[model samples]
Each structure stands twice: as structure tokens, then as C-alpha cells.
Target chain A: MRIAVDLLGGDDAPAVVVDGALRAVRADPDLNLLLVGPSEAADAVIAALDPVDRARITVRPVRDAVRMSDHPSAAREASTVRDAVAAVRDGTADAMVSAGSTGATVTAAALGLGRWPTIRNPALVATLPAVGGPVVLLDVGGSLEPRAGILARHAVLGAAYAAVAHAIDAPRVGLLSVGTEAGKGDRARRTADPVLAAEPLPCNARYVGLVEGYDVSSGARADVVVTDGFTGNVLLKAVEGAYAMAGGPPAGGGVPRAAALLGVSGTVVVCHGAAVAADVASGIALAAHLWRHRATDQMAALLAGHAWKGHDHIIDTEVTTP
Target chain B: MRIAVDLLGGDDAPAVVVDGALRAVRADPDLNLLLVGPSEAADAVIAALDPVDRARITVRPVRDAVRMSDHPSAAREASTVRDAVAAVRDGTADAMVSAGSTGATVTAAALGLGRWPTIRNPALVATLPAVGGPVVLLDVGGSLEPRAGILARHAVLGAAYAAVAHAIDAPRVGLLSVGTEAGKGDRARRTADPVLAAEPLPCNARYVGLVEGYDVSSGARADVVVTDGFTGNVLLKAVEGAYAMAGGPPAGGGVPRAAALLGVSGTVVVCHGAAVAADVASGIALAAHLWRHRATDQMAALLAGHAWKGHDHIIDTEVTTP
Candidate 1:
């Protein structure tokens, strides 16, 4: 499988991304990389590999990259992220990975590949290994201000992704909130609780009423946790910080630096902007794994079985707390 | 100083509360407690102490308690939490501590003690030990849907509390958001960001723009982090879960079980509902520390210097994201 790697996507771009690409290419014998950045960065990867095996690597040679501080609209212009999405659209790459700005990547993928039916807000799903199993957390930074209906839609996406990607039977889904009680969150959570309860989930997943932050790491209450991108992004980073404070991660694993972007009609992985070489390598590996699993197509097929009109109904009942 | 203890509070009440009282009384020679619950629970505290030292303990003997599942309005009735608050109001206790439902505790404290001047929404502040110093987080669960104005008010309270309670000189305050960029979070954060940056902070604290979730634990960006109650509450618990997942807490400490309820007339500490014996003792100790430092009164005095009228302007600019 060929995965497009954005060479100038991270804070320490080119250097870390090049090192990560070398590690990813060396780890997987069948993996081929389409380096999507400056030629010098691509040469760094090619020079590190054996002469005979260098044929597995190719270069797109894009110059500019979207900065972390740039607006999402900046992705509309020429950039490595936009080019990577185009490669996926043209079927030159099975999947793409970027350790750049999450907003830019989401915008580029949604614009180039197009979103799935009825998914106005795409979700970035991350799986953290828990004591019980893998816990799926969505909208890590995809749609920062999703309404209740959008959150309900994400519940469906997360359930389907958990089943297809992780092969978990009857994944238990829970809405992330301040408390586990039925009505214990802000306006969005209070409105989404009942909507999610009524919405039919695919893959035999059942909606657990509500879950607290602890459930994200323990995975005892639910295998899948749905939240707004704002909260999920913060929670994911706080967990990462806590792991760092505690010396290192547990025996299971550390926080997943790579997250899958759902709703867009392609396999895409977005890494943390402050990603190290290992994090970038993991993002590349995650992209390859998702592409091999055909997880996106399977989730779309499962989602097609249901009639999703929650977006239309969201306008009437959305909460305005002012 | 005398502190009132809600013996019927928490999931594991009476048992842990009685044990906690014993530990607290043994630790502090001048500390006195007014146990509010069934007579038997109070008797357990007295029975464990020597006859001469038993004089430090008193009993209110209120049987009813607001359950964790009960509504916050339930605290308005004749519950143990209300009685404990009444003891503080009547000069029998200097402060109060409860490990019951946070909603019930906030409600009981707000109603019984009354809110401070110009502070319509009370904030629950928690102090976390970070590598740099003690990072103070506010609005943990008091106001779930605070407007930008309320968040600005919380920034002031968090700053003062950090100075008086934790002795952090000229603390740096930051508004919590998805990203550190100016316009990176939900509507509330975007609205609150500029308001906080412009609002004058008490105790010489300065606003440091927006900070991500990792700052809450790292203390690398800001000494005091401000957010709406929903995000702060969930983020606190998630950090605790991360610590638990990483074998144990750092050498500094774990997520604080006790949080101080600001914007009220009296000093109060609310422990987590799932608090253990050690957690209860820590809550009692925190209450005693705040009372000794006169944190509530000092904060109120400092706040009097500012003309906090942000609440009046919130209605006009609050985002209605449908």
C-alpha cells in the first residue's frame, strides 16, 4: 500500500518527518511512500534505504506547507496537505498522513475528497488503549463546535468505525460529559443525550446514557466515547500530559498521536503538530492499517443502512445558553 | 478553626467521613469539627477519640442527605448538606466540606452562605501540582453554561485564589481552549478570550491569552487556567484517569479530590463524590487551610477593587451556533 507522507507538516518538519518516514518504510517491507514535500526531504528518505529497495519510494515535490497558525481556508491554496489529498482522490495513494495543522488537513480532505452523505461535520477519531480494551474517542479536533445533531451523527460514525477498525462486537457507545448522570452536561450534551438514545446504531452497538472523563482511559463503561471536537481535543492532550508527568505511559500504550478523519470519503490520518519522530511514524503506520482494513468503506456501508436526517432537525432544538 | 463535615455526603459516606474526621482531628491539634448526619455517625467520630480530646467534636444530627442522583434543588430542603452549611452561617463552624454530589454542594453553599457581590455564578476552583508550580483551575462544576462574562469573572477569582490560597505571586491566567491561537475554540472561548485578556485581574495576575489542555497539568503556560465548568470538570477527571492509567500519580501529587467553591461568603471545600477516606481527610484539611488563610475574605476584598460588569454585555455578543 502506498501512503502519502506530508514531509513539511510538523513543527520540526523535514527533519522529524524524514526520520519518521525512514522508520515507517523500514518497519513495513510491503509499504511504499509517496513523499509530498521538498525534493531534499524526499532525498533524505531515499538515501537512507538500500539501493534495490529505493524503488518503493516516490516524490511529489511540493514546496509550501500550511502553517499551524494559518486559517483553514489557507488549505484552498497550493500546499503539501492539499496536494496529498489530491493524490488520494486520483488513486495514486491508498491513504494519506500529515503531522501538520489539523484544521488545514480536515479542510483540504473535505474539499478535495468530498464528505459522505449527511456528514456536514467530519470527526477525527482516536483510539486509546485501555485496561479493558481500545476506547474510541471522536471529534478530537474535526468540528470544534458541533451541535447536538452533529454529535448524534458522530455517535453513529464512532460506533461503526469502532466495529470496522477494531473488530469489536457490540461496541458500547457513550456521550462524553461532565457527569455520568442523564442530564449532567452543558446545553449540547443535555440535548444530545436523548437524541443519541433514540438514534439506531450500526454493528449492534448500544448507546450508554452518559460517561465521565475517566471512562476515556479505563474503557470500563463504554468502548466508544463521543464528544465535541473542543472537549475531545483538550481531554486527549491532558491525558498525554498526565502520562508525561507520570514518567511514561502504561504497559498498554501512550496517547495515540494519530487520529483518523471520518466523514470524508478517504482514509486520512492527522498527527499532532508537536509530533516527534515516533509519533509521525505511528501516524504513517495508522494510515497503512486503516487503508488495509478498508475501514472507511465498511463504515460508510453500515451508515448507508440508516436514514440520517438529524441535521435538519438540529435547528429547532439546539440550545442557546446565553 | 471549626469546620462542619457532612457525614452523609459521598457514595461511601459515614464510614469514610468518620474515618476522615479521626485522621483530621489527629493531624491538627486546634481543629474542631461539627459532624452533620445521623447521631450514630457522629458517635463514631467521638468514640474513636480520647475523652479529653472528644470535646473538639460536635454533632448536628441531620439524617437526610441529597443523593448523587438527586437534583441540585434538593439541597434547598432539610438535608445534611444544608444543615452543615447552616452551621457555618450561624458561626458554629468556620467552613464546610462535603463529598456529596457537586451540584448539591454548590447549591447548598450558594443558598446557605449567599453569593459574593456582583457574582451571580459561583465557581469551583481546584489546584493541581504542576512541574512549574501549583496550577489553579476554576469553574469545575458550579456553572455548566457560563457566558464569556462569567468566564471573565472566574479568571479574576482564580487569580485571587492562587495568590491568597497558594501564594503564587502575580499568577499568569489563561483561558482554556482547543488551541492556543486567538480564534481556535468554540464560540464561548472565542468570546471569552478577548474579554479575559482585556479584563483587569486582581492580585497582579496577567492574562496570557489562550492555552491548550496540557497547560492545565503542566503549568508551563499559565499558573491559573480558566474555563466553563463543563470543560474544567471533565478535564480534571480525565487527568485523574490518566494518572491512574500510568501506574500511579507523579511524585508531586494526583488530581486533587477537593475543590474550593469561590464566589460564596463562606470558605467551603467540595470533594469528589467518589472520594475515599484519604480524599475526605484531604478535603477537610483543604477547608481548614482556606479558613486559616482567610482566602474567601481576602479574595472578596481584592475583587472589590474591580468594576466587573462583563455579565451585562454577554447577552449581546454570545454566539448562537445553530
Candidate 2:
């Protein structure tokens, strides 16, 4: 599968992105990278590859790029992430991977590749290896507000992603809150709890009452954890900080530095802003894996078959303008 | 100062609480405990101590303890926590400590001691040891909804607590968000960011723009980290879980399991519901430390002298009922 790489996305920019592209091509023989940046950066990857493997790489070679400090509105301009999104939209690449500003990437993806049917906001889904299995967490930073409709939609998206991407059967979905007891949490959670319970989920997923922060890493209580982008983003980073404080991560692995952008028509993966070469490589691999499994298409199909008839009004009313 | 101890407060109450009380009395020669629970539980602590040291222990036997599963409103009944709060209200005890339901303790304290001037919701402030110094996090579970005015109040409360309790000079206060950039969070955070920046802080504290989850564990950015109780509660637990996932905590220390209730008229500390003997002992120590320092009274005096006159109307309208 061909994956578009945003060479100007990360803090280190061309250097780390080039190194990551080389690694991604080597890791998978069939992997092809459409390097979307300056010619000098694309040449760095091409010069590193063997003669026979060089053909697996392609260069879009766009000069103008978005800087980390640029406003998110820069994504609308001609930039590396926008070019990468265009590659996927035009079917030149199977998926796209970027380590740029999350706001820019989300804006580019949602605008370039139209959002799926009932989703006004795209949710960023991250999978962490838990004690029992992989736990799917959604809306890590895509939609900050946790309205009942947004949370209900995230439940369905997370469940479908878990089933299609991770092959989990009958995934147990949970709303992340302060306590497991009923009627716990802030105003948004109190309003969202009942809505999630009634919302129809794909893959035979059932809504578990409520789960706490530990459930995100332990995976003992739920397979798919749904939360507002704000809480999920903060929780993910806090877990990373704690691991750093404890010296390193546990045996399973470190906290994921990449997340999949769900609800967009195309496959998009966002790497952490401070990601290094290895993190970018892993993000590209994740994109290729999703593309190989056709996770987005399959999940979308599952969602299409089980649409929430009365929930459209809820989404329109509850989802605030960003 | 004599402190009231709720013997039936934790998951393994009476046993853990008795052991904790015994340890507290032994650790502080001047410490005295007014144990509020069944006579049998108080006797265990007295029996464990020497006859001479036993005089430091007093019992206020009240059998009906608030169970962890009971509704927070149950604090209105004649439960152990209610009796403990009454002991403080009637001037029989200088302070109170409980490891029971946080909601119950907060409710009882707010109702019995009365809230500070211009404060509607009390905040749970927790101090965590960081590389530079101690990082103070507020609203751990007190006020979940993040109103701009409430957040502004918490910023003041956290800054004053850090100065009065920890003696941090010119503490740097930060509003917690997904990123350090301005306008990078949910609606509440976006709205509160400007308010916190403009709000006057006590103890010569200065407002830092914004901080991420890592700042909570690492004091490199800010000394006082402020957020809604929902994010703070989940982030604290998630950090604890990450530390557990790793071998253990860093050399400095683990995440704090005890938090002090701010904005109330009396000195109170709330321990985790599943606190152990050592945790309970440490919580008692925290309460005594606060009482000895006269932290609450000093903070109240500071607020009274520099009240946010125009902000009271904002709090009334913005503070949503749970």
C-alpha cells in the first residue's frame, strides 16, 4: 500500500520524516511512500534506499510547508499535510500520515476528504496494548466538548473500529468518567450516560455503565473507552508523563504517540507533535496496517447498516461549533 | 490541635482507621484524635497504645457510618462523617479527616462549616512532589463543571494554598489544557484561560499561559495547576495507574492519595476511598500540618482583603448545578 508522508509535519521536520520514511519502506516490502516536501528531503530517503528498493518510493516535492508555529488555518494553504491529504483523496495513496499540528491535520482531513454520513466532528482513535488485549480510545483531541450526541457517536465509532481494525468480537464500550457508580461525573457525562446506553452500536457492542482512568491502560473493564477529546487527550498525556516519572513504560509498551482519525472518508494517522523518527515510523506503519485491513471502509459500512434514526437531531443540536 | 477522625470512612474501615489513628498519635507527641465511630473501633486504637499515650485519644461514638455505596446526600443523616463535621463545628475538634465517599465528606463539610465568602463550590487541592518543588493541583473532584468564574476562583485558591501550606514564593499558576498554546482546549478552558490570566492571584502568584498533563507531575512549567475536577480527578488516577504500570513511582514519591478541601471554613483532608493504613496515617499528618500552619484561616483572610467584587455575579450565573 502507498502511504503519503508529510515531511514538514514534525518538529524535526525533513530529517526525522525522511528517516521515518526510509524505515517504513524497509519494514514492509510492499510499502510505498509519497514524500510530500522539498526535493532535498525526498532525495535523502532515496539516497538511503538500495537500488532495487528505490522504486518503492515516490516524491510529491512540494516546496511550501506548514511550520509547527503556524496557525491551524495554514492547513488550507498549499502545505505538506494538505498535499498528503490530496494524495489520498485522489487515490494516489491508500492513507496519509502526519506529525503536524493536530488542528491543522484534522482541519485538512475533514475538509479534503468529506466527513462520513452523520459525523460533524472526526474522532481521533488511539489503541493501547492493555493487560487483556488492545483498548480502543476515541476523540483523544478531535472534539473537545463531550456532548451526549458526540459521546454517543464516539461509542459507535470506537466499537466499529475495534471490531474492524482489531478484530475484537462483541466489544464492550464504556464512557470514561471519574467513578464507575451510576450518575457519577460532571454535567456532560450525566447527560451522555443514558444516551450512550440507548444508542445503537455496531459489531454487537454493548455499552458498559462507566469506566475510570485505569480502565484506559488496564483494559480489564472495557475494550472500547469513549470520552470527550479534552479528557482523553489529557489522560493519554498524563499516562505518558507517569511512565516517564517511573523511568519507562511497562512490558506491554509505551503509551501510543499516534492516533487514527476516524469518521473521515480517508485513512489518516496523526503522530505526536514531539514525535521522533521511530514514532513517525510507527505512525506510518499504523496507517499502512489500517489501509491493508480496509478498516475505515469496513467500519463505515457497518455504521451505514445500523444508522441511528432519531439521533440525527441530537447530533445537530448537541454538537457545538468548533 | 485535636482532630476528628471518622473511623468508618474507608473500604477497610475501623481496621485501617484504628491503625492510622494509633500511628498518628505515636508520630506526633502533641497530636490528639477525637475518634467518631463505634466504641469497639475506638477501643482498638486505645488498646494498641500505651496507657499514658491513650489519654491523647477521645471517642465520640456514633454507630451509623456512611457507607461508600451510600448516596452523598446520606451525609445529612447522623452518620460518622456528619458527626465528625459536627465535632469541628461545635469547636470540640480543630480539624477533620475522612477516607469515606469524597462527595459525602465535601457535602458534610460545606453544610456544617459553611463555605468561604463568595465561594459556592469547594475545591479539593492535592500537592504532588515535583522535580523543582511541590506541584499543587486543585479541583481534583470538588467542582467538576469548569465555569470560567469557578476556574478563576480555583486559581486563587490553589495559589494561596501553595503559599500558605507549602510556602512556595510567587507561585506560578497554570490552567491545565491539552496544549500550552492559547485557545487550545474545550469551551470552558478557552473561556477560563483569559479569565485566569486577568484574575488577580494572591501570594504574588503569576499566571502562566497554559500547561499540559505533564506539568501536573513535573513542576518545570507551573507550581499550581488548575483544571475542572473532572479532568483533574481522572488525570490524577491515570497518572497513578501509569506509575503502577511501570515498576513503581519515581524516587521523589508516588502520586498523592490525599487531598485537602479548600474554600470551606474549617480544616479538612479527604483520603482515597481505598486508602491503606499508611495512607490514612499520612492523611492525618496532612490535616495536622495544615491546622498547625493555620493555612485555611490565612487563605480566607487573604481572600477577604482582596475579594473579586465583580466576579461574584459571574459565579452565580455560570456555576451549573450537578
Name the regions of candidate 2 deviating beyond 4 angstroms. A317-322, B317-322
Per-residue accuracy of model 1 over A71-185 as CA lDDT, tens digit each? 8778899999999999999999999999998888988998999978777667899999887899999878877774788788888999998999999999999998888878778
Give the C-alpha miss distance for residue A27 in model 1, angstroms. Answer: 0.8
What is the iRMS for every candidate structure?
3.7, 1.7
Q: What tens-digit string does per-residue lDDT give for candidate 2 at B1-322?
A: 8999999999999899999888889999999999999999999999999999988999999999888888888999999999999999999999999999998998899899998878888889998877777999988998888888888988999999999999999999999999888878888889889888888899999999789988887789999999989989888888887777777778988888889998889999999998998888889999999999999899999988865733853457433222
Give the Cα lDDT of each candidate. Answer: 0.88, 0.88
The deviation in Å at residue A166 for candidate 2 is 1.8
- For DockQ, the strongest prediction is 2
Measured with C-alpha atoms, the lDDT of residue B104 in candidate 2 is 91
Give the CAPRI rating of model 2: medium
DockQ of 2: 0.64
